[model samples]
Target: MADSSCGPRPLPPDDLALLSGLQPHDVRKVAESKIQAYRAMIEDINGYIIQLSTIQNTTVPLHASLPPEILMHVFRHILPTGPSDLRLTHVCKLWRDLIFRTPEFWVDMLAISAVTAHLDHNTDSPLSFPSFVVRSSPLPFELDLHRGALDFLRTIPSHVSRIHSLSLHLPLGSDYAAYLTALFNLDMPLLETMRCSTYATAWPIGLTDSTTHRVPDGQKFPRLRKLAFCGPGLPTRAFAFPSLRELKFDDGMFSEPLGPLMDFLESCAQLEVLEMNIQSPARQFRTERDAVSLPHLKIFSLLLDAPEGLWAYDFLEQVIVPATAQMNITWLAGSDHPLRYLIPTSPLSLSVEAIQVIHTLTIRFNYDRTVRDDSKWILSVNGFVPSHSQPYLKLTIHCPCWTLEEDVRPSDALSDLSGLFTCAPSLQKVKLRLDHGITVTPDHWFVILNSFPSLSSLTVRIGSCRSLLTVLRRNPTRWPALRRLSISCRNGSGVHECLLSAIERRAREGSRLEYIAFSGSPRRRLSEHRMRRLEGLVDEVTTVNEVEFCGMH
Candidate 1:
């Protein structure tokens, strides 16, 4: 009989006949032969695997030719804790092994929330927080958590000391006191940088919330060098950062009493860079304390939006910096208050002796009465030391104008412009750009021009060139020290005639220009005919292309 294990299917006619004629011994022998063939096939497969393994071990791939250290160094250029790093581990078996062994590749541990996934496009399955911490071993690593920051910190209490940098991004409308308390309670001895930000509408813990959850006393980050707080938060109080050198606060308004803010600044005595953008409240009650002294501060930037009044000036009176420090102050105030109020005729916060000898001054005045909004007027002043590539001081003031007057009085414009240059007595180079919306008579321009008696070089832009030419034609002896003149215009149609007339008139008066250059758009370039005319009146004449002229500005 056929084996019952073969199931109910009937065998082929010839196979059935052969099986009937064969004895039991013949069937057993056939089965033994089939078993031997299967063994031989398994052996062949095993040998093939061994041969392939031997080849892989003996032959080196192109990437494997380099030393493991060099390859790891190249991988460092790729992003640390993202899909890019995950791809490196899957390139080949050799690379996979090397990436797993190298601890530097796993030094940045990140946990991202769905809302902030755009900040870190990491969706790899292998990046568990604990796995990263263990894989990174004893080396210092950075921790970036976009959400669930407080809970994550709870699970890794022991690993806080190894954190090199920590960044936390909190959701909008969430209470920030818990986050701050969690941060203050921890001890981060090796931490070098810490950044905490939120999307809250206002500071989470304001003056009203000061009574709740006070920052623990005697807490400090000893090695912290950089601290940044964005969005809004409670006042910094009762914390010490002896080595902190840089601090930044953006989009925050200090609560009514400025005492807490002052106390926080007093702790960071060695700060080198301090930047803040806060809104100042109206009622200016002078904080009854000595100015916070930041002698080591090299870059100080303060931006304020005070609609009720010019509280920025009053606030700045409490802070003192070095005379050589660079300052950039921007204030947005009501139209009734002039820039002269914010930047007084006498130096308010800046040292008088340091600003008295500035060499280069750039004045950019833009105003449009037609648009009755807060951005209708902006006055920008930049001062530079002759040898320095960076400006030592920059002051910009914005005001809202409700008036629709097409023309303003000449004296009104002169008063505002003259009061600005009182501190720049030693200025030798001036770049003046005025918007077309502002209208002024030639006499006003002449008065403004004569204020810089020591100015030897002048650059005029746009419609301001017409007023300058009129001033030069009206009074050839206006700016006696002016020798070099550069004029840039949007259109050069009737500008050539004005330039020729002014230069010829100035030459006839014996105060000949030493050099003159005219630049405009490609389609509006001065004709060669007019270029020759200007060349005769001045010692040297040049026409600058549009691309080159924009850089000069």
Candidate 2:
């Protein structure tokens, strides 16, 4: 009989006959198997739901808390370009509204061909800049307009009037008169600096006419301090600026006579610094013995490519003696030969005290060919060295040569150097360069180094390392006061190690060696371990607490 406590009894397919045929164990096994399969199916469904919920939590967008105004300021500092920066406005309504209204972001404009290539090809007017620049902030600003944008700038009266610093580079043969006329008329009362480089064909002839209308009389740039003109065929007529302190004329083709240029300088009485490089081969200047002097001129640099035999020194002497007697003068002449003869020796004696007052003197002797031995040349240089009455002198000598064969070795050329050192007993620092392929014997090196007893720092550049080490071993005492030593040679690996060992040996014996630099070409495929070992020995020296090993090609 079936148990009634089991709730309800199952119906048999063939009633009692089928039930009698089946065993109780088989029925129990089938029922248990079915239960296990349904349990596993439910677990899989639950796991899938959990995975979907986790993905939703991680992939959702999060809103930023920064204010729109601060974000716009950040954007203003970046040069405007790139899809990422442009699409930033589309991220939200707040960003779009803030960026569109901030005109300060557009005040300082720079339009270049590389950046505006797409705009240049699509429009009839390549320079139709986005209107934001035309209606920007009220603050004085800078405008850098390059390539073919000068024509577009002429139409923007508002932009021109507010520019405090303007840089324009226009093509050759463009009508720059309209642009200049606009600049001359613009009421940029606060404009302080202007740099313009224009290349134009047909030469701006109208700009050269001295009789053309001038900058309004009595109008002065009270705050303007600097002006630079880098253009071809610039008019030489005088322009007035009473408050200008620095003036630079670079690569300008002079059209008018020197009289007008001199007049322009005289007008700027407050001018302190003047740099002019005249490129016109045909331009000539008439010397005015009674021309106005530059009373306030502190620094003057004139670069000219005149006839070799031209009496440029006469003009320079005239300018120097009266106008700027108290000024520290720096004269650079680009000539085929040395101009040591042209430099007046008589003036040296007259102004020896005044010239000695100059804190720094730089003489750049540019020679195309080998400098032939000139006795007068040596005497001229020696004359400039102040007498012992002046304070100690700091000297720097730089000679970049292709080969040492052309250089006059100190041993062979010690007479001039001896005279120079004797004239100035206060010499403190000396630098000597012997270019590649030039060899100096150990004996000659010793003689040269010993000449400057007061030098605290010495740099010797040689072509061969073996030769340099031989020299150092011979006379280490000559460099007792040297706190810094710099050596450049060809074979550096073994030489560097030897130098380090020698310096250490000296330091252990009580020598002051503070700094050492070994510059040379390294051995092929040297490992870092080897390099470090070489560096460590030099570092261990007493006077040299720090050492540098560089591998230069």
Candidate 3:
């Protein structure tokens, strides 16, 4: 408070006198120490001056002031995963430095297409493949090599040890056996996933060697866990995969017998998810080999697109899925078996370990053009646990014809459904949706409704509601437990007469429906008189658009 001015204080007189009495050497030492102190003071002052100038003349960015660790985290959060992340280097010097130092941003940033484009001088990429491989450093990385990237494929063997995932998108007839053999010969200690797909094309032409990928006799993938292989056969023989947890095989042109493939699967007992989609599966299994048991399997999907006899069922009989797994099988319907016999004559025909009781059933008949623009009907049967959106058991039958008069008759389909009802005696709900030009007779509806003794809800959406309403009108006590009923007509035909008669008959028999929902196109909405009549019959009546009704149900 005495003198608030900015300046150095003078040394006390006694201290100055002590310095004046020093000898020559002492004086020199004291001078050097004082010089060092003054120089440090001057340097601090210069720093202050610079800081003040910066505050006054320029703005300091907030990011520049942030610590490097925080900046790295921010950069990772804002950056994309692939080559797009490299654009951050152009933002500023701090960002560039942070991105360069952080290895995670460069891990998944390498794509063969971009790298080869740079190699071929096709584009001026910011970072070359070699640069990324170096900048990513010792951390594990994912690699993607598409068809015709043999130049990069040649470089894979050098870096295969550190790869976490490798995906090779070979086209129909790729000839990368030498490169693939070279890559597989090396041990991938860090590899967790490997996918070799032909992009849904034909299989490869030749094997790596006469037998398998000359993979050093006993070479194995020590840490490999997930594998998705699609081709005529696996690239390697019974090479051990002790850590494999997920496996998927999708080969549309698999022509080999089941013996070799089954022998390969017998080694992977720890698999949790297995999916096999082969257009034509092997019809016979080696009699000496027992069913392959997957104790830890959580999801199993087998799609046999062959339009032959029960190959899907035969494949299921060869795999022993645990009771806890969810299963889906899509089999093409053959011309010999009726629609009812397309599935196993009984659920016992499937592996006992794979069967789960059905509580809810959904059958949908819709037209599809998947088979070369032909008119086909896809009958998808989905069974689910209560309150579950994902089906536990899904069976799909693909038929070449779409109408009742065609390859499949509605009565035969109902008879097949009745057989399914025998399997699920406790079935509580059923939903049937038929597209246009497919109509069932009232007798078929009568048989199907009487089969579900415990069905509490029934929803029907067809071309016409005449058969269903007539079935209900004839007998009100058929489905004694059906409390909810929803009906929609595709043609939007006037259903008021038949619908009112059905509801009146049910009411007269003391079988009152708790909820009734009727839907059709907007052009065929129920008139005011019909709406009042329906509301008076049912406790809760809803008149919705056909689209909204389907969505809500």
Best by TM-score: 1
List model 2 lDDT by residue over 1-553, tens digit each. 9899987786555444434655799766665765687689889988887677554533444314455566777767766543234465575555555665655544533333333333332243413453544435565666665665556556566665566776666444334455555556556676788676766545544455545535334253456778787866342433456667888876565444444455566566667777766565345456644544666775665555342212334444434332223322222322222233232323443222223233222222223235553311221121123333222222222221111235453334332233234223445555554435446566655655565566565555556766556666555565677666666666654565567555655565555467666566655322466556445534532211112322210
lDDT of 3 by residue, 1-553 (tens): 3354867677668557758978999988877887798799999999998668655532456744666798788765553544554677876555677788777777746533454344332223446565676567778887766655445645545666777887776533354555555555666788788887655434455542324433233234677888887765453443336577888887647564555556556776788988887776544566676788888898988777666545665665677777567888776643334544444536666533422456788888776545443236677877777666787777776763433345557555655556555555557888998877678888788777776778889988888888889889989877778889998886554777888899988888888898988887677677899889888989999988877878855
Error of 2 at 495 (Å): 24
TM-score of each: 0.66, 0.49, 0.65
Count of clashing residue pairs in every prediction: 0, 8, 0
Q: For residues 1-553, could you state the per-residue lDDT of candidate 1 as single tens digits?
A: 7788978866467555555656799977765776697699999999998678655843676554777778777765555544454676666666766776666666642432332233322333345565565566677877777677767766767777788788887544444555566666788777888787766445433433334534344344678888787765423653336677888877455444555556667776888998877764542433677878888988988777665334555555667666567878776654345435554336544433335656888877777667764366776778887778788778776652322343334235434555556666778888877665455566667767776778789886655367768888878876778889887776555667888888888889988999887776567677788778778888998888645755674
* Shift of residue 478 alpha carbon in model 3, Å: 3.9
lDDT of 3: 0.68
Q: How much RMSD separates candidate 1 from the native structure?
A: 9.1
The 10 consecutive residues of candidate 1 with the worst lDDT sum are: 112-121
lDDT against the true structure, each candidate: 0.66, 0.49, 0.68
Q: Which clashing pairs does model 1 show?
A: none
C-alpha RMSD by candidate, in order? 9.1, 20.5, 13.3
